[model samples]
Target chain A: MKISRIVSLVIVLIAASYFLVPLYATFQFSLQMLRGQWSFQAYRSVFADPNFLSTLSYSAVTSLVAILISTLIVVPTTYWVRLKMPRVKPVVEFITLLPLIIPPIVIVFGYLRLYGSDSLLPLTVSSAGTNLMLVIGYATLSLPYVFRSVDNGMQTLDIRTLTEAAESLGANRSTIIFRVILPNLRAAIVSGAFLTFSISFGEFVFASLLNRPAFGPYLVQIGQDRAYEPAALAVLSFALTWACMVLMQIFANAKPGASRRRRGAAFNPLARRKTA
Target chain B: MTVADDLLNPPSQGGSARSAPAGLPGAKAPRRANWAWLGLLPFALFAAFFLILPIVYLVTGAFQTPEGTFTFDNLIALTGPAILGSYWLSIKLSLVSALLGAAAGLLLSWALVLGGLPRWVRGAFITFSGVASNFAGIPLAFAFIATIGRLGIVTVLVRELFGFNIYGAGFNLFSFWGLALTYLYFQLPLMVLIITPALDGLKTEWREAAESLGASHAQYWRMVALPVLSPSILGCFLLLFANAFGTLATVYALTGSQFDVVPIMLFAQIRGNVLYNPNLGYALALGMILIAGLSNVLYLVLRSRAERWRA
Candidate 1:
């Protein structure tokens, strides 16, 4: 047992090293000032350029806008399906989840065919609407994660009670939805929003196909046109992605504990044995 | 997984909720948006417009001639030599990458779940995996450039220090093996995420009990843990296969369309001027979608099997 464990430990370390090499090397390359010297020139070069910063910021704005739109679509739909028309839950779920199941290229191909040239609709290439469509694609990319999380959250809460309580007080429909249900499902919303933001921020497919002024295309341009600088930018992208992913894991993990808390309070002793 | 499982139980759910409200019952649902599905309509609309309709056009158009006659020429062209070679290559690449990813992920998950690590270290590994996994298409290609490209840092350093060029050593990144290696960056981490839960599901008691019963470490793992984790390991492998099969962005960025893997070839046929047969491209896409659909069907079957086991 001891010998096997030692072997496993050694193997794990080697795999870890293999997995982390590109990350470490990218950092190493980025930190070099002279040919072999350690310096912050890469960081300076990245920040010194207005184009890079503007493009990254532009990508961030798209992500946020996409998140807002997703929230607008997902939250109410999820809430309504759970509370009233529970039958359509599967259809809603299917539509939202289809993007993940389909190959991204197929979807992107579909996008280009539908809007790319003078074929289908009145499509202005690279217009704001084009950018908006990119966000819509991103939101679709993230729908599964958000929908699952929020739908899970809705299951744990006493929605009927909360709604009745609010309605009895003469709160309007919009106020009840925006103020009450949204607040309860906040964590899932944050998780979904953050997921959309991270994915959209790193998105390459729609952004590239659409030729939008986004971080993905910007990185691609930097890599092909200017290799070393793109390495430095890749490090920056890695850091941003690393941070957001941790936040996502934290959200996914907390879900179980949160549901347990709600159920614990609601379940009587009889229900405990029944559940167990 | 909680919601994912619940959604899978279609029999327990309602039917034809097209315009019905599915939220809290306090608010009466006779309003315009509140009639049934106010918020979800836009997303469904979004899916239909961008995701559904385009694919409908792209795939359906494959069956028609350029002048509008429905025909199987596009589908027939799928079995041609050029396409058959590329399809075989794409499937081969997908299988190799997914299996390689599964092996790497099994090790990584062992380190993550059972191998002891400090909270911060575990946190870092998990975070790094998520970022690295999601960091698939664009930035990964960029990182590989700095680290592995012909004039990349490692290649350059190899020349100056040891007078050995890895590219000259026949480790090319612009070829088949190169594309596979690039894919490992995303595939391995994703497999780790998917397989970790299954590894975690393995009971430590079983290992300890097996050991105390005079079983060797190999016996404990081979007879006990491997069997226990086999379903997830299998499911995750297929998921990775599906993922790699459909991938467009990473390989495209790495080798351009010079590689001519199925997705790239399909993209070239439809989108690239060089391949002017859009109908043929649609037929290729149909094949791709059929494979994707098969994988999902496998997921459903396996997922239900998972439920049965638990039950």
Candidate 2:
């Protein structure tokens, strides 16, 4: 038993170091841009660059819009599938998982060809159209995560019962959706939104292929030419990813008041046995 | 009938009676079913415009000449030395990284779960895995470069501490092995996140039963645990393989076009007019979709099998 514990400790330590060393190295390197002394020079340079501001804002806005679009699409579809169209659940699930099968690079390649200037859609011709394409692409890439999150959320809630209750109370379709379903799904939507944000924010292939000035391509550009700045940016990116995951974890664990109140009611084993 | 009418009177209330004969139950059911399918229309349209149409276009374009005539020439061109070499290199890199990441991640997961670590350690590792698995692309490349690049801190430390240079020993961080090593940063964490639940699903009774049957520890693992866990392990391995196979930005950042992975090669084809062939580019993309699709399909099948065992 003691030997096994030691072995476990050793393995844990090794894994921990593997996860930490690159982060530590990146942070350390980020601090050493001012030759022979520790400094925040790399970070300062990154923040001060005008292109950084533009690109980061571009990515942030697009990712937020993408999150909104994904939620709008997934929530209704998942809800409808659960409440009314249960027979189509498998088809919905399969469509949601299609993004996982198709590589982003391939999808983007297809976008380039299909939505070119000569094509009927011509979404790649104008800069604004290209940005719209980027948002749409982001939405597509985040479909699986958003759908799964919302589906799991719906699974926990008795959607049919809730909808019936709302309908009996003379609630309209939109009222039930907006007031009842959306409120119950807040935690799931927020978690999925954050996941979408993280994915689309630092996304490379779509934004790059569409020739948008997003954060990902900017980071790659800096990575090519810069020394310490890329490390600083990497540290920043890691912190952002960490923040997104932590927030997602927190929201995902925040069970609705309805469920939490039910959990608190204590049940006696004797009562259960007598009932049985 | 309009969608609003269908929604206002659900199928159970015989909503389709207005569109069909009132007494014909069979006619009512099919009409109601068709209206219910309209609920999926918006989502289906979004997918068609954004995901399906674009990809289908490319899939079809893969077999067409640039002037829009049907041809197998582009697909045949995939066998040429440069393109085939890139495909081969990408596969090797993905295979090596997936194998190494799967093994390491399994070890870490085992040490955390069955190796009897404290509960908090598992929590921390799982949370870290969640973040690390998503931490990919350009920043990942930058982090790796900071750690193990030519003048990276680790390389510097190794030289100073051991009086030996890694690069002097032909250990180039821009090489294939270096890229695979970098890929492991995300790949290993992904494996951990995926395989942890499968590890948790292993019942304690199985081990105790084997022990009670006079089986030794190694024998119990070999006879009971491994066979049960094989599907999950193999599934996670395939997932990791697909994940690595589709990666582009990280490899592009690390090697800067010096190493030509298939994605990077396709990226260049799309970006530049030099040696540009649109059909060939489509074929390259079609090839990527095929490999990624096949592996993911296998992963899903294996996961279903593993899930049955768990259930």
Candidate 3:
């Protein structure tokens, strides 16, 4: 037993160093921009660069759009599949998992070929159209994560019984769907949204291929041209990824019915007064 | 039973009229099954345009010539030493890294899940795995470069403290070993995330039963535990292989397009350095799809088999 404990400690220490050292090195290197002293010069330059801000915001906005689009598409489809079409669940699942099997570069390459300028639908013609394509591509990439979380959420809540109960209370289909179902799925959707954000935020293949000035391609460009700034950017990127994971962990641990419970508590006093 | 009955017997036109006022709680209302298909249309259409069509384009374009005629010339061109070498090197790197990552990750997961560790250690490892697995691409490459590259902290520290130069020993950060080391940053964590559950699924009763049957520790592992874990282990190895195989940005950022992995090659080809043959690029993409697709298919099959054993 003692031997096993020692082994576990050794493994943990090795894995920790393996994972943490690179991060520490990157952070240290980022602070080394000034000669003979540790400084934030690299970070200052990175913040001052207009491309950094534009690309960061560009990627951020697109990631949000992608998350919204995926949620709009996946939530209804997942709800319907569970409630009405359980047989097609496997088919929907297989399609969702396709993005994982298919590399982003290959998918983007296909997009470039199929929707290039002079094609029947020239999505790559205008920058706005290209941006739309980027969002669609990101949505496709994150389909697996979004679908899985929402499906798990739906499974946890007995959707058919809930729908029946809502119907028995004179709730219409849209009301039950919009008010009753979506609220229960808030935790799942938020977790999926953060996963989508992390994916699309640092996504390089599509943005680079589609010639968008997103954060990913910008990082690659800076990595090539500058040294300390790239390290600073790497640290920043890690922090972004860390932040997303933390939010995802929090949402994953949140109770699905907590909001409903909170509402019930708030109205309990009113009910008590009426009864009295 | 109602679903099965609905499939077997369609309600007659008069039956619906007769049953309208006979509405009982036990009887299911005849659902419009066609509406279910309609509900799936948007997802299907999106996937068709973005996912399926692009692959079909690559597969079909691989067989087409510049003049739009079908030919195997592009595939034959893949047999050339240069392209073949890249494929060989990629497969080797992927296989090596996957094996190394899988073995190490399996051990780490075993230590955390089964070892007498504190609860928070496992939680921390799992959470860190989630972040680290996604923390790939350009930033990851830069992080490794800052750690182990020529002017890197570790390299400098080792040389200063131990008077041993890593680079002098012929370790180039842009080489195959360097990329494999960098690939482990994601690969190991991915393996841990995947294999931890598989480890958890191993029942304690099985080990006790084996021991009661006079089986030794090694014998129990060999006869019982390994058989159960093999499917998950193999599946995860294949997944790691595919993940490393399909990598592009990390390899591109760490070692410029100079080092030729298939993805990097395809990236360069798509960027108009296509050697005047677009079909060859298609063939390359098709090759990547085949490797990544086949491995994932195997992983899925093994995963299903593993689930069955657990059941």
> Which candidate leads in DockQ?
2
Candidate that scores best on TM-score: 2
Full ranking by DockQ: 2, 3, 1
Native contacts kept, each candidate:
0.53, 0.68, 0.66
DockQ of each: 0.34, 0.38, 0.35
TM-score of 2: 0.94
Residue pairs clashing, model 3: none
Alpha-carbon runs more than 4 Å astray in model 1 = A116-120, A124-126, A249-257, A260-276, B1-40, B115-123, B156-164, B204-224, B307-311
Q: Estimate the overall C-alpha local distance difference test score of candidate 2.
A: 0.82
> What lDDT tens digits, residue by residue, belong to model 1 across residues A1-276?
465456667866776786788788888877764676788887787788888888888888888877777777788787767766778888887777676677776777787777766765745375976877777777667676677667767777777677767767866556767999888777667765665566577676677767788877777676677646777887887777667656755554555334433211111100100000
Give lDDT: candidate 3, residue A106.
85
Pitting candidate 1 against candidate 3, the one with the higher TM-score is 3
What lDDT tens digits, residue by residue, belong to model 3 across residues A1-276? Answer: 789889989999999999999999999988998989999999999999999999999999988888788877888888878866778899898888888787778888899989988589999989999999999988888787777777766767878788778866877666777899889889877876776677678778888889999988988889989989989998998899889878876776674653233212111110100000
Please state the Cα-based DockQ of model 1 relative to the true two-chain complex.
0.34
Instruction: State the TM-score, rounded to 2 decimals, of chain A in model 3.
Output: 0.90
Quote the chain B TM-score of every prediction: 0.79, 0.93, 0.90
Stretches > 4 Å off in candidate 2: A257-276, B12-29, B273-275
In candidate 1 the C-alpha lDDT for residue A110 amounts to 80
List the per-model TM-score of the A chain: 0.86, 0.91, 0.90
lDDT of each residue in B115-215, candidate 2, tens digit only: 87779999888778777877888888899899999889999999999988999999987998998888898888888877887888989899889999999
For candidate 2, lDDT tens digit of each residue in A134-222?
Answer: 89988888788788777767777888889888877877677878899989989877877776676668888888879899998899899
Cα TM-score per model: 0.84, 0.94, 0.91
Give candidate 3 misplaced runs (Cα > 4 Å): A168-172, A257-276, B1-31
